[model samples]
Target: MRQEKKSEKQEEKNKECLADLHTTDPRDDKERIKQTKGGLLEDSSNWILKHDDFRRWRNNDEARLL
Candidate 1:
């Protein structure tokens, strides 16, 4: 009874948290993809190049090294 109601509230809270986690800001996704794919490989590669850890490894670098 009371336990069931509490569980339901907890479930709703969890759902809201999950929804928040899943919702992507469009700009963030675009930046993520730009950083991911080697498409940022150019003289103007600001975002990807700025991320030191990400820039340290490429597809080939990962395969051959780490």
Candidate 2:
């Protein structure tokens, strides 16, 4: 009976962990561009890019590069 109780507690903990793992907050590209100087293309093979935000960021520190 004690072992069954412990197993049930472990199952509850696992369910909570799985819920946390699957949860994510939606974020958009514009917000990301403003927050981060650089952006990435969706295609895996696509090249890294620098946008207007990157230019602004680079302007602040010339040493920063894409």
Candidate 3:
């Protein structure tokens, strides 16, 4: 039940993010660049690369292929 509530909140947040992207002004190139460099896109990718689970999985895969 708690997990479902968290999942619903995340889904709503994602929807709002997508809606905001569509509403952003196209003329604001500087704002777009700032967002691209410093926003969720970069943060999420960085998190994945640095995450412990990903690191362990990557190392295990590399060792397995040897």
Per-prediction TM-score, please? Answer: 0.38, 0.40, 0.35
- By TM-score, the better pick of 2 and 3 is 2
Ordered from best to worst lDDT, the candidate numbers read 3, 1, 2
Instruction: Estimate candidate 1's RMSD in Å.
Output: 8.8
Indicate whether candidate 1 or candidate 3 has the larger lDDT: 3
**Which wins on lDDT, candidate 2 or candidate 3?**
3
User: What is the overall TM-score of model 2 with all chains considered together?
Assistant: 0.40
List the lowest-lDDT window of 10 residues for candidate 3: 38-47
- Per-residue CA lDDT of model 1 for 1-66, tens digit only, reads 999999999999999999988967899887989888845556675777678676566544656654
The TM-score-based order of candidates, best leading, equals: 2, 1, 3
**CA RMSD for every model?**
8.8, 11.4, 14.3
Cα distance off (Å), candidate 3, residue 5: 0.2
The lDDT values for all models are: 0.78, 0.71, 0.80
Clashes in each model (backbone N, CA, C under 3 Å)?
0, 0, 0
